[model samples]
Target: MKKLTCTLLAATLAGTFTASALAADYTFKFQSSDPAGDKNFQVQQAWADRVEKMSAGRIDIDLLPVGSVVKHTETLNAIKLGILDGHITATSYFSGKDPAFGLIGNTVGAWSDTTQLLQYVNYGGGYQLMTELYAPYGVKFIGGSTTGVESFVSKVPVNGVADLKGLKLRAPEGLVQQVFAAAGASPVNLPGSEVFTGLSKGVIDAADYTVFSTNQKAGMNDVATHPVQPGFHSLPLIDISMSQKKWDKLPEDLQEILTTSVRDFAYDMTTQLKIADQQAVKEAQANPNITIHNWSDEERKKFREIAREQWKVFAQKSPNAEKVYQSVTKFLEDNALL
Candidate 1:
């Protein structure tokens, strides 16, 4: 009887130790703006996995896709209320809160590559500006990523700035629409859902949408025969952020792990998308119905010049917008991008 008692006590002690070892110190719930199958969202999941390993399982992130807990646009508010621990989303979704978000969300026509945008945000003043923009809403901005430069879709060939003269195209509202209009193109406001229909029915000639592989996969290339590669305009900013309150509870080392990991995530995402675009271009070239047009450096410069003029007009929308304009322009000028 005494032997049985000792065995049971030993088993109980071992079980307790195992449970204690497995229990996590922190488990964060992050909702991604991308759908479950989206390439970006998958990379986000990998990022979470890496964080768990880095923290030795003390930190575990449960990453959910869009609408898993709340609407995508509502995530900003949800995090403030502590309903969500963090989010991976486009800052433009909250542009309604401040014109600064609008300008910083996507500076439309400011970036031609992923490295330039990431450099501006990381080493330049963009990181500090993002913190200021988010803190007022109870969120801590971590880092930013992108889908690289988005390719343009058009049924007719648009080779240069000359082709934009009076051309009718579908574009997102605000800065993108305004920039296109300023460049002498007639910009139409249309939802993303209607882009294929609008293009197929001859309602518009071109649209500023997403990356090349995404468009090709969705049959966008089928209807729009002419696609401009190495797109000249619109590289959006995707933000990774957390509830400021929750972030304050984390240890300093954990905080650094999350921040540095996100920066690495951006580099991973950019490279993967670039490879996807290259493969899609190869497939697209094999098809006789499609024609790829890559803009020349000279043509891109002219369009950027037109875009810069509209930036000045948007800057006057609010005080925050003005600050963003000043910061962005200073960065551009310092980098010789101006």
Candidate 2:
């Protein structure tokens, strides 16, 4: 009887261990520079949801928005040091570390449309190049996202290039800042969160915040009575990335799951933002005091000329910058846009 009882006990212990092993769980977190209420933030949450369902209970994900979990500037470093699993960061912020990362940030005139940018990154080796550039720093580029283009907006009338000089403009990194500085405007560097307050208080005279939808949300029209068109400084192509260490450690199945879902999220986000941007512009036009200005062909050509010279200086400073320029140029030529 004692021997029989011991045999049954061992069997029960073995069954418990097997069940526990089968139920093992893996959880990870993802972060972005946008706030929770932003569309991009919602997309990140959607990604997490899809990933969890695909992985069943074996994998879990959490979303961190804005700089809530990590400072925007420090996000890349945090992920490199293994402080976070993944993040959606601007190519501009990382330019100081690797100018090649600025390829998407500064690729003006190369991509005329969102679809073209998407094709180049996913199919034209841009995506692979981005990953290679980030690899040495212990980060992995996980394709792209859409923040739409950065165009000019102001409280005063800006009818031409001549009007841009001497204006206090808020500019992000890459060609946009360079263009404004070259044109003699004092380009201030401020994060996205501070633009509204800066404009309201007259800290900036003109600014290029974001897509029409996001800019509307930021209330750029509230203080800036005039908004410009043709998006002189096109700042499109935001990217999503991962910590190399964390990515490699993920189960092969989990990695595959994220790889597919993130790309889908990116495409969806871009399309949605584009639609919203168009509508926002129309809505902004309804306001009585706001005036919209469209650039002439001659005016557009002048901006491009200034950009060409600026690109030369950028290329001279960073080899990565040159590589990105070449890649974008190739894409443009292949598409016959050049």
Candidate 3:
């Protein structure tokens, strides 16, 4: 009886130690600027799942949707303060702090295709500059995902730049808003959650939100009759970032895994969004109440012209902005997009 008891006790001790060894060493709370049910959020969740599995459960991330842990605009500060472990957020949301962020966020009318912009960020010194911009805030830029050309959903048809005049449009707070205002439109600053209600209640006449797919998912088609095609205003870049302190605490291998996972996620998301946007455009066209209009190339050129001026104004806002602006302009020039 005594020998059997000793063996059982030894076995129990080994089992406890094994279980503890297998448990995740690090757990991060990752918050996204997308609400639950949105494709962006779904992609984020998948990224988290992939990371956990790839890490062999060494690192676990809890993905939270928009406003679940903190307000979307507050994510940067939260990460900096270590109140949040990480965030997947639109960089432009912080443009008020530094126009450099705005330059990195979209560079309105800069790239006709999302992949072009993605290349600029991944290979054109964009990631380095963005890292420098976030360094002061104690945050690290891990990676970013891009949306295809955005849609300009409107209650009234916008055949050209002239149609924007006096129209109340819900635009983000950045160069996009400034450019829209420059085009003679009244730009209202509203969160993504407020956009649908704003359009439905007539608080705003139009909104330039995410791609056609996300807009459709948000039910924009039900309220807006006209959606401008070949969207020329914005192609937002959503970044994944972590607190510098927390990042430094991670093992080197874990850090590599996290960053590589995010980059892979970005690539996957771009392809998924492109396909999804195509489907959404098709669905919107089939809706009897929805009318899709494509702005003439000349009109697109005019909008880009106005946007260029606004970019200059935004660059002049800060030294950092100038630096980011020069980098992006050089990239465009190199690619002959300038």
Candidate 4:
């Protein structure tokens, strides 16, 4: 009987020790603005997986889908209030709070590819500017990535700038909307989840939502027959942010693990998105019902001219907006884009 008692006690003690060792050092509830089944969301999951492996399970991030715990636009506040540990979302969603957010979120018609934008943010002092911008909100800027050029999906053929006149389109709330409005098109602001229904119900004549792969996954091509290729207006920047309080509590090694992991993930996402976009474009062209058209250089030039005017208006919104605008423009000029 004494031998049995000793064995039971030893087993219980061993179990307790194992459980204690397995406990995660940090368990974060991280939400993303990407909807489930989208390529971006899948990539986010892969990012979480990589972080977990790199951290050796010391940090466990719970990845939630768009609107799972909070509205897409409300993630910043949720993170600040501690309702969520962090979020990966488009920076433009907070443009209403500060025009600087939109200017930094996406500099419409400023760059021809994602690499330029990434370089500007990672090495051109953009990270410091963004960190300063979000400091007042109690959020920490971790890192960011882009979805590359989006397709302008429309029911009607938009072969040139003239086709946009009087056309009703759905655009994100920021520089893109203003640029579209200036080009004689009526721009409506809507969440990405509602875009397909808007197109199906005849509510919007056209939409500029996401990368070609994501749009195809969302089945946007079925509803919109004419999609403009090499989309000219916008390339959105998606950011990873955490609560300042949570960030401050992390150890230096953990912080390095997270930041580096996110940066590498950003590069991976950009490459995957670009490759997927090519496949989507090829599949779209082979479909008989879909018609893909590219805008002429003159049309693109006209759009860029209008975009510059909108940039001036955006810069006038606040001092910070002006600062971000100047920084981006200087980067463009240095790169020979301006």
Candidate 5:
């Protein structure tokens, strides 16, 4: 664990800044998909701190939370234009670019654990395929991070696919929403900023958002009294990527510092957040206002089946999607996860 004294400026960094204007040899304005209140955002700041230490103060990452410099979905373009240097965001948000992004981004219901996804990304050709996917856009796929298995936020009990029928919920986007809609729920698209108010004001009945710890920490349980534990849906790949042009100019040692620091950050995030999740679960259990739902294996299997069917359908959307679909299924099959 890193000490809290390592500082990284996390603010609205919307313009390009050069090293000449800062103390470090390089200054990257990186944006995260998580809001400032999210624990994931705190972890991101820590990752920035790790980079600074790993680079011996030669790199400065001005980490901004979601919507700080650009809307969460716009960071890839922002990086290409040098409006921002990089992003820590979900790949599924770019599903519109290619269903490949959606297929690889969440692979909805494919992961019962995060290690399965990480194993694929780091060793199962996912890294190479993702690198190729990003090349055309002038971005370099650095590495991926996760929030562990996510928990569902709900205002009502959802025990099975049958329970999802007509339930209106705000899914993160694209792949997740498509899966839920296929499972018989009415999936609404809403940004993270609006979720709490959406639930409190009766705008939506549920959400497929972040980890149990994050939802609990955000007081989401107070309004959305029922939550699904050991989430059976999405476990997103939080992609860390930089501008290809920026990456090319880095010294080999500096490049190593950035990539290696990100790998360490991924492990750090998964470990710490899982610990926080366990603690939050206990807190939720003690709260009278909340109901934690643990779906039976049979119910979970049913949801997984629905998700698998959607995977094949998505693969047909584009050539790139087919590539992602094929590689991902092979990984799951080889790992005996399918």
Candidate 6:
């Protein structure tokens, strides 16, 4: 009887120790503007999962995606205020805080393929430039993921530049809006969550969101009759950011786990977006109600010209912009991309 009692006590003690250790583990919340099933949401979840597994559950991430608790445009400030812990944002969306954030997203243009977009942002010093730009705002930059080329979604068919003039369009970022204004289009600022409703109601005639997957998810297809391919925008580099205060509070091992997890997130998002874009195109083509508009060479040239001009204006705006421009230019030249 004494032996049995000793064994039971030992088991209880071991269980208590394990429970105590778990209770002492770190916990955090990850928030995003995208809802569940969003590519960014999936990527964020994958990252969280990777971190938890890698740390053996020493770090726990509670994911809140799709702006469930906060508005999409308010996510950055929310994180800064500690209202949320982390999130993924597009350069264009976040660029409202600083124009420099849009450089990477804008420079590549609609003709810039996914490879070009990734090369420009990752190897071209785009990420470092972006991180430095956001540092002053009390946010820690994790990295970015390309969303595939951005294209115009229109209710009216767009086969050439002439078709774009005077069109009321939803432009999320400052630089992108400027690009639209330069092209003689009316640029309106709106949140991602409102885009579909706005387009359906004719509140805006067009939108330049990244990739087909996002648009289809947003139900842009139902409202817009046409989608122009070889999108003028590149895969937008969605940024994964954490509040500086929370980041600094983490232990070195935890920080390492997070940074590594972010890299994994980037990879997952990039791969998923690539696959999504293809699937989206296939689905769009199959829909009889949707018209897939292909740009004429002349129209493509005109758009590229606008993009190049915008790049020059962008570089001239600030020293940081110039640095980012020079880095991207050098990278493009180095790889013979031009």
TM-score of each: 0.95, 0.86, 0.94, 0.94, 0.90, 0.86
Candidate 5 root-mean-square deviation in Å: 8.5
Top-scoring candidate (TM-score): 1
Model 2, position 26: C-alpha lDDT score: 69
**Cα error of candidate 5 at position 298, Å:** 2.2
Please give the TM-score that candidate 5 achieves against the real structure: 0.90
The alpha-carbon lDDT assigned to residue 130 of candidate 4 equals 90
lDDT values for all models: 0.90, 0.75, 0.88, 0.88, 0.88, 0.74
Worst lDDT window (10 residues) for model 4?
209-218
Cα lDDT for residue 59, candidate 1: 93
Q: Please provide the root mean square deviation of candidate 4 (C-alpha atoms, Å).
A: 1.8
The whole-model C-alpha lDDT of candidate 1 against the native structure comes to 0.90
Point to the candidate with the largest lDDT. 1
Q: Candidate 1 at 214: error in angstroms? A: 1.4
Better of 4 and 5 by lDDT: 5
Give the Å shift of residue 277 in candidate 6: 2.6
In the range 139-198, model 2's lDDT, one tens digit per residue, is 888777655665577888887678888999898776768867887788999876788888
TM-score of decoy 4 = 0.94
Better of 2 and 4 by lDDT: 4
